[model samples]
Target: MIYVEGGSFDMGYQRGRDGADNDDVKNAKPLHKVTLHSFYIGKFQVTQEQYYAVMDKDSNSHFKGDRLPVETISWEEAKVFIERINQKTGKKFRLPTEAE
Candidate 1:
């Protein structure tokens, strides 16, 4: 895990010809500032092998490599895996929120 120093920043971009082209960027809206608190985050995306170690199940990725990020898991499965890992490590482990 990496420790992130907290700070405040504007969350959205200005709307104009010079702004982001994608419509999805509009979801950021109102150009408001947000404050964050110090928190720990994974240094890298979780790997297939790491997921397998925690969950004791194959990641089932077609790529099939230890270094590759695990993908295509349902939310419920991920929650269960996180719970199991928390139990084993005796520490809280959770997915990052969008604002983080």
Candidate 2:
């Protein structure tokens, strides 16, 4: 895990036609500011072996490799995995929000 010293910053783009063609980018208008609190996040994505160590099951990634990042898991499944891991390790862990 890596410690992130959080702070505030402006988020989103200005509301105007300035070559942002994508709907997603256009919608990111009305620029806003956001603040975040310091937190810890994994330095690397969870690998197949790491997931298996905690969940006691194969991730079933198409390209199977113990060192590869686990894939094909739903949000709920990830939450359950985190819950189980926290129980086993006695540490609080959660997925980062969109802003984070």
Candidate 3:
């Protein structure tokens, strides 16, 4: 049950091309910034062990153990898992939309 504290962060390419012209989506970007408060996050990606523990069934994830981050999940399904985690821990669990 590792928890990750959240914070505001910038999300964008570290460098823009020298000739990056205007109207380019590269520049068409809005504030690629995400502002969220402190919340718990998985120290590792959701794992088969944890998923089975919470959902009472294996995702049949190929990772084979708790050490691997369970991937191949849809965005909506991930949200559902997060919601369940929040209920169990009494703290919010979510994904990051930015880079620190």
Candidate 4:
């Protein structure tokens, strides 16, 4: 895990050298400020082997590898995994909120 010391940052978008043709940039209009608290985040994506160890089920990813990031998981399944992980490790784990 990496400890990220949080601070205020300007979110949304302002006109840039690269014109506003990108819909993603245009949607982030009317720039706003956002503040966050320090938090820990994984340095790497969770892998298939780790998922299986916690959930007792193989990941459904087509690309098979112990080290590969687990995929084909629905939002609900992810929640279940977090719950199981917390139970086993005695540490709370959760999906990051949008602003995180």
Candidate 5:
């Protein structure tokens, strides 16, 4: 895990920029600031092996490899996995929010 010292930063794009016609950018108008609290995040993505160790079941990832990142899981499944792993390890773990 890596410790991230949190701070505030400007988020979203400015109103005028070349090639900003896309809807995604349009929705991001009116620059805003976001503040975040310090937190720890995994240095690497969750691997199949780690998921298997925690969940006690095959992840059924499209590409089969112990070191590869786990995929094809829904948000609910990930929450359940985190809950179970927290129970096993006595550590609080959760998914990061979009701003995070």
Candidate 6:
């Protein structure tokens, strides 16, 4: 997820509305503006091999491919991966904030 610093742009959906949900009518309405900061992200994803190399265990990740992302990981698992990557890379690679 390599996130480039964001620049201003208009975003829109390709499809038209069917019916708006209540939340959409209330808090989600108006489809307003947003602004955010620049950051880096994983271009593809953290692959199973990349994860297993650091974590040293792959039995839990049943996807069984070097190229595929290891799924079924809980939040704790995600944090461990973040910590390992940060430790190995010496850069604070982390999960993106919801705001981003």
Output the number of the lDDT-best candidate: 5
Off by over 4 Å in 2: 26-29
Where does model 5 exceed 4 Å of error?
A: 26-29
TM-score of each model, paired residue for residue: 0.80, 0.85, 0.57, 0.81, 0.85, 0.68
Better of 1 and 2 by TM-score: 2
Point out where model 4 deviates above 4 Å.
Answer: 15-18, 21-29
Provide the clashing-pair count of each candidate structure: 0, 0, 1, 0, 0, 6
Model 3, TM vs. native: 0.57
* Cα error of candidate 6 at position 76, Å: 1.7
lDDT of 5 by residue, 1-100 (tens): 9999999988778756435568778666467899999999999989999999989998889999999999888899899999998999898999998788
lDDT of 6 by residue, 26-97 (tens): 444343456777878777877888888988888276777888888878888889988997899898877876
**Ten contiguous residues with the weakest lDDT in model 2:** 13-22
Off by over 4 Å in 1: 17-22
Candidate 4, residue 39: the lDDT equals 96
- Residue-level lDDT of model 2, residues 1-100, one tens digit each, is 8999999988777745445567878567466899999998999999999999999999888889999998888899899999999999998998999889
User: For residues 7-63, what per-residue lDDT tens digits would candidate 4 score against the true structure?
Assistant: 998766667744665876766656689899999998999999999999999989888
lDDT of 3 by residue, 1-100 (tens): 4555666766544345334554444654444677666655445566777876776776766657676777766778678787887899898656665452
Kindly list the per-residue Cα lDDT of model 1 for residues 1-100, writing each as its tens digit: 8999999987766677336667777565667798999999999988999999998898787777998988878888888888999999999999777789
Q: List the residue pairs that clash in candidate 2.
A: none
Report the poorest 10 consecutive residues by lDDT, candidate 1: 12-21
Q: What is the lDDT of candidate 6?
A: 0.71
Model 6 residue 41 distance off true place after TM-score fit, in angstroms: 0.9
- Comparison by TM-score, 2 against 6, better one: 2
Clashing pairs in model 6, backbone N/Cα/C closer than 3 A: 1-41, 1-42, 1-43, 2-41, 2-42, 3-41
